[model samples]
Target: MSPSHHGTEPVFDVTGVTKVYTSGEVEVRALAGIDLQLFAGEIAVLLGPSGSGKSTLLNIIGGLDRATSGSVLFNGRDLTDFSDRQLTRFRRDHIGFVFQFYNLIPSLTAWENVSLVTEVARDPMTPDEALAMVNLTDRMSHFPAQLSGGEQQRVAIARAIAKRPEVLLCDEPTGALDSKTGVIVLEALTRINTEFGTTTAIITHNAGIQQIAHRVFQFLDGRIASMHVNEARIAATEVEW
Candidate 1:
């Protein structure tokens, strides 16, 4: 997880990636010829308006969906050619996803929710350790209903990272929270990215969150309209959002 371990290899190499959704009488292009490289141990933020294709690209990169044309390479392997089973195993063994909703089991304690993934992971950290990483160790036995929104989201993050995945892809992670609560959640994510060196990519509608990322890619009309590096990265607590 050290910065030293991050070599020149790109974690993701996407080329000519395009996604087209077909219905009865219409074909919608969600992504258009996206060619980019995401390096190891870097935090990349994808920003755009609704239907701008940021979420679509995130899903494709996370293995939840596939590009209709072109190739997606992860560490030199072509993901576009991977079978269903291969994609499932790739997601299970190497990717972690967080969405706007916590999606925690109401009946299970925080510890139990995270343990579910640890049980299936190849070399997972303990549920307790995962919870502690998000600073929720004291609430290990608390149910989702018993915790606040941010706490629940942290638990969800714990569950995602319990498997020790190399990539953490979060889609609208703080969309449902108030500003104060959202800041805490962002801080937790920042901490996790720094501590684990997990290559993190966040899809957010909030433009203010761009300051927190090492690099930002702005999507528009199904293409990356702009991309820039934040030489002076802002901490989550200091982020204007």
Candidate 2:
């Protein structure tokens, strides 16, 4: 299938996208006229300090939020026009998300948590395959409280990928972990992107994580300050703290 049809074509096509929030009489411009394109089978890193609009852009693309103006197209579908119901369906069928906190259900075992997504997915991988991808096969029966921080994050990754979503969006995925543990989590993410050909986008303040990306975009004051293509990405394990 063409990338346009299956999100295999440039995974994202963002054009002149802008977001503005009005709180009483005050208006906050979270994104200012941004244009970008990202492709599948690659890892893209978004770098910026706090309040730089990195999170805003990620949210719009992931369908968690909407842009006030401009266009966001995934594959060829114009996301700007999608209704709330349509966005939910799109997110359910095509997107997976990871956040700084490992948002696992406290009552569920690792395997049970990972299996939740598959139950709602159109065509999903088995929980065992997803756990194995993150090297958490042995911890399937463990609960989140019983696992280490890194292990819990791996279970989160397993849950996200078990649905076999075409896109994986991560925001400050390692912010809550130590550098050493974070790298291990990143390795699992890298493995998922490489092995499944999932289009991956990561937002982080840590420049150290950029070494693993095929492309990097830097945001500043609600705009893209710079962008670069990395010919070679260093392994996550090789990144320096």
How many residue pairs clash in each candidate at the backbone level?
0, 2
- Report model 1's TM-score to 2 decimal places: 0.96
Cα-based lDDT at residue 143, candidate 2: 92
lDDT of 1 by residue, 73-157 (tens): 9999999899999999999999999999999999999999999999999999999999999999999999999999999999999
| TM-scores, one per candidate | 0.96, 0.95
Query: Mind giving the per-residue lDDT tens digits that candidate 2 earns over 1-241?
Result: 1123352467789999999999999999999989988898778999999999998999999999999999999988999999999999999999999998999999999999998998888999999999999999999999999999999989998999998999999999998999999999999999898888898999999999999998899999999999988877799899877
- Candidate 2 error regions (>4 Å): 1-8
Best by TM-score: 1
lDDT of 1 at 101: 98
Considering summed lDDT, which 10 consecutive residues are worst modelled in model 2?
1-10
Q: Model 1: which ten-residue window has the lowest total lDDT? A: 1-10
For model 2, state the Cα shift of residue 81 in Å: 0.7
